[model samples]
Target chain A: MTIAYAYGPNPWPQSFWDARAAANFVCGGAGAGLVVAAALSGARGTALVVPLLAGLAIVACGLAAVFAEIGRPLRAANVVRNPATSWMTREAIVAPLLFACGVAGAFGSLAFVATAAALALAFVYCQGRMVHAARGIPAWRAPQVPWLFVATGMAEGLGLWLALAAFLELRSARVAGWLGVAIIARYVIFRIYRRGLGRALAAAPARALDAAGRALLWGGTLAPLVLLAIAAAVRTQPWAPWLLLAAGLCAALFGAWLKATLVLRAGHTQGYTLPALPVRGTRA
Target chain B: MTRWAMVADLRRCVGCQTCTAACRHANATPPGVQWRRVLDVEVGEFPDVKRVFLPVGCQHCDEPPCLDVCPTTATRKRDDGIVTVDYDLCLGCGYCAVACPYQARHRTPRAVFAYGGAPAKHEAKRHDPARIAVATKCTFCVERIDSGTAQGLTPGVDPEATPACVNSCLSGALAFGDLDDPGSNVSQLLRENRHFRMHAELGTGPGFYYLWDKALPEAAQ
Candidate 1:
């Protein structure tokens, strides 16, 4: 559907926040999710160490991606100055705290584990608000976006946990159960988020986003759940661990794809508008 | 203690785009980056069509969303209500660009010219290396306003102190003045004409006011 705007199309450049920005969202969200899942599972030794290190590395890479995106990377420390208003500032402030706690937690400190989990959640929430604060983009301005990010982050984290478990030959019903719950929550929240976006966006962008959302639901959300269900049913079989691994891979990739689309494709500036006047004319 | 404002009289404006040219010449902005441009809006069907030219740029709002979202504190609204960007502080993250509903902010990472090639002598002379990769927008001719006011001349009354867009307007559609002063040209114009601001519901309290030709039927009585 070709939607006609009264004030013409957006004159400014499209893709203001490009692939690099999308990478930031994908990595940061998944990393924070993994940290939270690790804290919750109480998986000690190699199990905890692997996921924690992987999560932190991904987040650090995301930060580097953002640094590369800025014109002046040398003056990036200025982002920490404005926590009272800017969400980007808040995210910068929380990231170091999250990393510190995660490192301390790895050394058998229960207090650090709890703190890391809390900080991870806060970091995820801050990323969500960063997108939400982009008031020009109708797709990002929805109130549900922040919550959607949180749900997807948790789901992605659980998916990473399962993948690590499968690789390490560690099988735990508690982790699988939590993964199921996280997937369900993410799926539900995504539905709500997509619906809100459809209403808020113009017809053309909305239709395109709707198709992306459907793909995510079927391939990302439901596929993972079905694989996990098969894993649960064939617990005694040799292929059960493989199925869990497949499900984990599917969920993590889906979360990454969703974040990429949100930041890169759905990110559109607010088209121009004229005052309410009864006029019948197309934009020149 | 002056609040800067602009009044674009729709009745007088002819879509010549002189204001756009004047702004470009004065600022020496690169290609594809227009700080000020007149939007040619054609209203009504072809049989009874009426073309209206709307001049648009940074509204310099009292409560600018761009200022609120700037992580580096680069965007700031001055005491006189003209919104400005500190190029040195801006990281060119484009957050302020995304926050502005007006789509006024722009970022040009690379240098490009009208004729293409190495930067022209004038372009190179005018270009500020600090401005590259940072957000840029209309400043309402702050340099002229400051210098002219310092010399004890009124902004709207004196052509030297006024913005290039307002000064170069051929049809005299654009008016710049202190809105806080009742005796100011913009204040008097506002009091006399039925003017409307774009996206007033956003609560940005935009300084740009478009003067309508006739009062609305509901507002007439």
Candidate 2:
């Protein structure tokens, strides 16, 4: 019988999902995060306007980036036709609903804001599933991927909210505390996800992924936590707002970098395999 | 109720790659795009090495991961079990490309010719413009099979209806027929030989079977 063997080091080309696709992940995570933060804060006036406009803009930009990656952009509308099976179709359906609800929420509809927040979470989840559905890629197919994305998206979104709050001089100890919790949750999930990857992946790719995971842990998760603690300690100081802003900025940038590395660099296809090979010292 | 299938007899195959050339010639596929390929795998250490030629393309699974992951509903499986892509409906997002464990799907962003500069007349005429930027893979020569069936011909029995690879296999290693029919050549081959479908544990239920000359130890006893 025919046997399968691992094809080579890298079976598929890296160009399949390029930088544009990575940008989509970053933008999607940030956009969903901002919407969730806005819903949580229930801010008014300039506070509301900043998140509403910025969130929608980032999400729209992410969609545009994905559009740029398609070979036939005109046929992209067909993506909504297979919601029964495709996560991409589900994402397409939820994204517009999130936008509409976010806009309505900004106009003072608390019901719409709540709906937008829920839809934003769903959109983020669908993004994770979109990656997870690639059964050929071991890293993306891990069960922990979606959870990691959800946690990271919320953390990044909350960090953006804090940055906006600092810029607008709005005081919300509750929001800052929630941001801290989200960052901590993200760190825990990131560790578990990396451990899962280490077990699932081959030696070479696993080492490479471990390197990227370490960077994400130090820069994306821990560094922001440190900055947030510093800001908390110096709350009475005049430069407290600046320190909070810096923490938020660092968190957001690191989240983006993490997603970019996961989607673009760490993404690899499952190679070919041959099942039937004679064991050493055994003759056929 | 015709469930199309293929059986490759590994014992008879000479690893000549004639099937590969025949498939390329029949399909007029662009350079670097091999709808069918014979992979030469060298197993064991250098002193006791054995070279085995494995022909792989699409397994044409019963539950195709590619079809399940296609966002555009472009990849479809016919009643006869051939998986195909509707180029018009495909967005070329490469989702199906990655979902395919078989590594069967391919997308060429730009057109290229075997020659450096220009495509030959026959090559230009045979090339499908719709498949340029979209995903494409082996169709099991559906057009020829369908046309032959309409003309009261059996695909496996008729050279005109059979796939290029099967038709051109000089060693009679490749056979194509309806697996549903007990009397079909593929079914008979499966019944008579020790055969296995690749990645069957993945629950793909692949239609392509590989037949080995040696029987299992238990079966031989």
Candidate 3:
């Protein structure tokens, strides 16, 4: 008889960590894009429904990331005890509450609540950054982390709609109208935070910070500008929205990929060894 | 209510995993279950780099996040603010682990036994299999403390009075005490050092604190 001798359990596999990290980063990037796009302009009627739906999607993805990392996904709700002290706790309390706010705002047509949902969207960004902060990884130390994430959420939402419009062949001048706005907002964010991001990219002190800074600028700012130009040109041409939407999709996808790659690579740069001591604890 | 806390003298810690092992034994944790661990990290570079060994575990925070996301009310905070997990009520859900910033919680694939000197005896002493599939972590040796207190071993000491890990520190690196008491060593250390928790910016408001010497070349800011 083969007995499953449950003496000791094994540590979680690398695959688990890898999958969680990849999914989290993608959702985070997309969520950032969405939130920014939603806030960039005012949406009325079912048009408003787009941002709300996007917000709900982001929340779902965030919950999935959380649930996937845990040992028990179902027991996920117990973390609401000290909103005053914990972000994870605050997220637990706020996520559903925020979702409820979105629902109430959507159904009741309350502008104030929709504004509140936008603010809550900012909190969701904070929660995502909070996870990275815990790992003690230097790459996560950026003050713009919250801003970057929120922006990306907005951008992702805009990209989704743009792509959807292209697929549906919908020719609302308003839809074509917002393309430049998304590009400008995304590019501005890149310039602000990523102008001199990394040493290798910036050609300076070779500090990881320098490399990260430059990468953010190029990947976030420069690359998107190129894509946006292509997209804008396509917007003016007949039957070009479809192509522009395709181009936007590529830009968003590549933009997210490049950004995540830089962040992950920066995390790996922190693996340098510490100085040795005669004993362990005391500092020399 | 005495709020228990720990202080590690960075001057003496030897990077040993004795505390980790002791915690496992004391808690009767299963395999792949580590309530405490020794993390060896490198800081700085070249000739100036320094190795720092931090023995980390659940901070048993004044504000425990694990207690927050538990849908089943499986985790709770003691009156003194030490966090404890109820394995029986835990539905093997991993929410609390994610909420924990310290990455302190360990969910074993199955129930485990604290092997005595003899493996057979250890298996015999293991908590019954009927009670498997629950979340758990160090409870500050609550059972031992209660018993020890009754026996006058110490004012608040219990059967597991002194946490096994604290006792196992060969270099006297770890110290535990009531943070609420001004006379307690933990409180005194807090008063003396401008230490910071791992992710202070997140506002987890962790009870665990680290004090690094300013003069140290390799200390992380």
List fnat, each candidate. 0.50, 0.53, 0.13
User: DockQ score of candidate 3?
Assistant: 0.18
Question: Could you give me the TM-score of model 2 versus the true structure?
Answer: 0.92
The TM-scores that each candidate's chain B achieves against the reference are 0.95, 0.95, 0.83
Q: Lowest lDDT 10-mer window, candidate 2 chain B?
A: B212-221
CAPRI-style quality class for the chain A–B interface of candidate 2? acceptable
lDDT of 3 by residue, B1-221 (tens): 77777766555677888988888777666655677777776656999886667766777877676665555566788876678776655665444554555656656544444453234666567655433545666676666655765666642222246667777888766766677888776676656544556556556666666655323334322
> In candidate 2, what are the lDDT values of residues A17-64, reduced to their tens digit?
778888888889888988888878878777876887688788899999
Q: For residue A184, give model 3's deviation from the true position in Å.
A: 4.5
TM-score-based ranking = 1, 2, 3
Model 1 chain A, poorest ten-residue lDDT window?
Answer: A1-10
Q: Which pairs in model 1 have colliding backbones?
A: none
**What ranges in model 3 sit over 4 Å off?**
A1-18, A21-25, A28-69, A77-142, A172-220, A230-236, A258-284, B10-16, B39-54, B61-81, B86-103, B109-137, B155-160, B170-173, B179-221
Model 2 C-alpha RMSD vs. true structure (Å) is: 4.1
lDDT of 3 by residue, A187-279 (tens): 566455554344212222234445544554565445655655665666677666765565456546655654454344443212212122334
